[model samples]
Target: MIAPVENKPEDVPPAVVDEEEAEDGEDGAPETQGAGGEGKKKKKKKKPKKKKLEQTEPPSIGLSRLFSDGNYPEGEIQDYKDDNSYRTTSEEKRYDERRMMEDIDETYNNIRKAAEAHRHARKWARKFIRPGMRMLDIADGIEDAVRTTVEANGLEAGIAFPTGLSLNHCAAHYSPNPGDTLVLGEKDVLKIDIGVHVRGRICDSAFTLSFDPTYDPLLEAVRAATDTGVREAGIDVRLGELAGYIQETMESYEVEVNGKVLPVRPIEHLSGHTIHPYQIHGKKSVLLYKNEDQTKMEEGEYFAIETFGSTGRGKVVEQGEVSHYARRADAPHVPLRLTSAQNLLKSINKNFGTLPWCDGTSSGGGEQLNHLVSQGIVQDYPPLCDVRGAMTAQFEHTILLRPTRKEVVSRGDDY
Candidate 1:
């Protein structure tokens, strides 16, 4: 069962050792060390207890460890009413924040390297993505590039999410299967989503590549939408307000298909997400179009602003093509009838705590994944496609929201 979140964390008690604890052979009896090498019965010595100091003045002086360098979100998420997980305790606040600030510059440097690795991988895709390239092979090559680049920095690094190479009408969530034989065509609209996490700090971003020049308007619309979000995002700005500007900017672009002109629109169903340690989709979501989301942007928070501009209607619907799986937030502990299901569940929890992954990347078969899905332990992200035969294009960036300005970590030539 999940524990309830506490408003204020309780103070941790100092470590104390019990002197009456038993040894391997003894049953709840105290043992003492003597001068003789062999075990011999010896009388215990009782030492005088130390007196505790009694003082009452101020709560400072010795409270530096608990009082300084806290990264607790100020003016954001003051409570856990909307949060899905446990509250960040005082202990975690002190340790995570102090350590993060001590290495804040190094953290930024590593994250930049990881973001560059992701960009390098995407750049490689632009030239290598041809008419007859298999989707599975493309995914492998892209992931290989990310892994190689990150490892060269001499720090722990890896891909944050499965390489998603959604094509044409498929907007996102289309990682290829191990034996997938789907090949690209000359007119395919490819979205390359790659992520890299160095020591758990991640950069989640993507860019769309179109072989046909006719879809350039759609690509331009998404890029404009993403840029508007970044421009409007601030420490005190509301998320809905930022989303409104992005939607307004996207609607200004028009696409010319055949002999008719249609106004390009952002997909309402998809929105940009915030990222946190090992967790891709974190706190708030920035919508492509304006709605009624009152989530406020806070200082020190990270967000990945993304937009999907479609040539058809601005709504993406699931088309039963699921290729990625993420462990549900409320993961149920239930027994499965098949042994394969049991093994897959163990592997999922061990390898990926809550991160999204592909079934082909796991050590189990399709049948094992199906069993877990039946039990509601896994959420399969289906391919979001346009209702009409509209081309889908996307642009994204991972950014850090500071008190004064925003830090774009994954900004590349595509932006």
Candidate 2:
């Protein structure tokens, strides 16, 4: 429930009397420190100057950043804390039952916890993903660690999407299928994409791993491109400018791989996407290269800045392998013949709210999931791979666009 905030003395605005004295005397003229009687002219001694006070935000509650309860009239300040800090009005018990503050606190805290869990998962994956490691084990282990860490912190959590461990020539979305055995080799280029969500606030970020020393330039190109993208993102900034910046950064590096010098190329099809609560890909798309679209980045939104650099051709196409699934539409499902289908559909709605999920954690198994997919209740995500056998690297970060600056919530030490 929305409750009254406690008064904090430190947050209160300081008195402005000293400021007035510094500018002028109490009577609007300079007051002399020496005894100069009535209207007589005298050489006056200057008094100690007072420091200027910092400005404070306006005390209008309805106009405040967080609370906008309509019950309180506009321009009326609800100083429930008595410290001039705007807060939810305490007189309205009905609004208290609505619990906007509590819900906001829960959502904000969950997002932070999710970012922390993702960071820990990436760190763990870095240690576990060595040469000869199985792809299935790495994905399952990292996802398990993320869920376990979030649940241990007193909230329910899950993977925002499938844990992807795409190998060389595969750019993105290549999670291992059940019973499939594929091991990492010494010369493989691995891209690990991870996601974690607490209460549907997702932190989507990724980085690449290369065992062969020759692909270091590819890795550096992707990392530099990601940094350029992050630096150029801002409120009302042109999306194409960011796209050009990232593309220019990646294309600058010419790497020596496979006994030939190849200019690094950005995967042109995959663009960084705007993110929303419970939704991974939102409205806006940031391109890998400059485009004719002039979409401007808006404030008060979150975006996932993902960049893909390749040592081969920049173009990527979908493979026949399809394993991940998310709901195609939000409409009510038509009645199915099998009881397992109905149960699995209900479980998906309950467990994975609008986010994409894999059958990895499903109890109904792949057979039932495939039945649902066939019925158009869900959609599949196939792996995107480069056609020219190029080793690819990717780096991504989740950002919140603010008025003056942006906040990167998925940052780690390695980034």
Candidate 1 ranges with C-alpha deviation above 4 Å = 1-100, 103-106, 152-156, 335-337
Error of 1 at 362 (Å): 0.6
Give one digit per residue, the lDDT tens place, for model 2 in 57-132: 2111111122223111111111121221122333443354345325654654456567766776777778777897
lDDT scores of the candidates, listed in order: 0.73, 0.73
Q: How close is candidate 1 to the true structure, as a TM-score?
A: 0.73
Candidate 2's TM-score reads 0.72
lDDT of 1: 0.73
- Tens digits of per-residue lDDT for model 1 on 240-326? 878889989999999888989988988889999888776788768888878878888775788898888888887888985678888
What's the alpha carbon RMSD for model 1?
18.8
Clashes of each: 0, 0
